[model samples]
Target chain A: MIEILLLVHLILAILVLSIRSLFTAVILMAIFSLFSAVLFFVLHAPDVALTEAAVGAGVSTFLYIWIVKRTQKEVK
Target chain B: MTTTLAFDLIGYLFVASSVVSLYRVLWGPTIPDRLLGLNVASAQILAILVLYAAKEKLHVYLDVALVYDIFGFVGILALTKFLEKRHRKGE
Candidate 1:
């Protein structure tokens, strides 16, 4: 299970880089953060898991989206 | 023993994932892409810290994760806000 999770995580990280859309990258990173939170909880760090769940998965993505929103390419 | 082994396995896996995300931070074409990469790496680091705290049975180390959680969001939020301001000015 650990190996499988690791493989998926690494692949997704690579996908984030390779993908063209910044929106997709933000979403992918949020997903990755969720996975990391689960991984942390499994390891018995409940506090950290909670923080990652709330902050990384939630707030960070919101901030990224906010930035991405205004910086969008001007439609010609 | 099995549980400990499992924890170790998962922890290492997260660490490896963060390493891969570093490439995006270094070479991303757009600023948002690079920030996205940074966000991923920092989130993983928080998880790694928690895993380490569990492994060492040191509850206090969890404080680092908490602190990181607070500051990480603030920093990112501020950065994005700044970007938004600059972007609006450009237009």
Candidate 2:
């Protein structure tokens, strides 16, 4: 089961890497980070999961959005 | 069994998103966009590492994750500052 989960996680990671839009990528990455946090919880690491949720879903997403806003260029 | 399966599903979702994020990093027109992608990727990796540490029952990996968190924070701040400097210089 874990193997299958890992496989799916890997596939999603690849998908994230392929998308062209920055906004879309950031949103997707947030979703990805959330899942990773869940994975950590499943693996019996609540502390790690908490960190993931805070940093990945919260801080990282915020940073990306900030950067996107700062640039004002949506193309490419 | 159900719990494990749930985690598996979640992991797959994360993998999918990470893959999509790569395109942004590869073709981002601006440096900040690339930096954002990189930052998101690092966060995801940190999560993955923590999960692995738990699965493997290794406490040491937690330390690695902590270090990664610090490094990632500093790195992103540095990059942001650099970009701000460049933008100001361009003005």
lDDT of each: 0.70, 0.64
Error of 2 at B91 (Å): 6.0
Across A1-76, the per-residue lDDT of candidate 2 in tens digits comes to: 3564476468668867877666556655665675576567557676787677667765786687678657853456
As for candidate 1, its clashing pairs are none
lDDT digits (tens) for residues B28-53 of candidate 2? 67667777777776666666666666
TM-scores of all predicted structures: 0.53, 0.49
- Cα lDDT of model 1 by residue, B1-91, tens digit: 9988988788778868877886786567777777787788887777877777788787666775776677567656755765577588884
DockQ of each: 0.06, 0.06
Poorest lDDT segment (10 consecutive residues) of candidate 1 chain B: B74-83
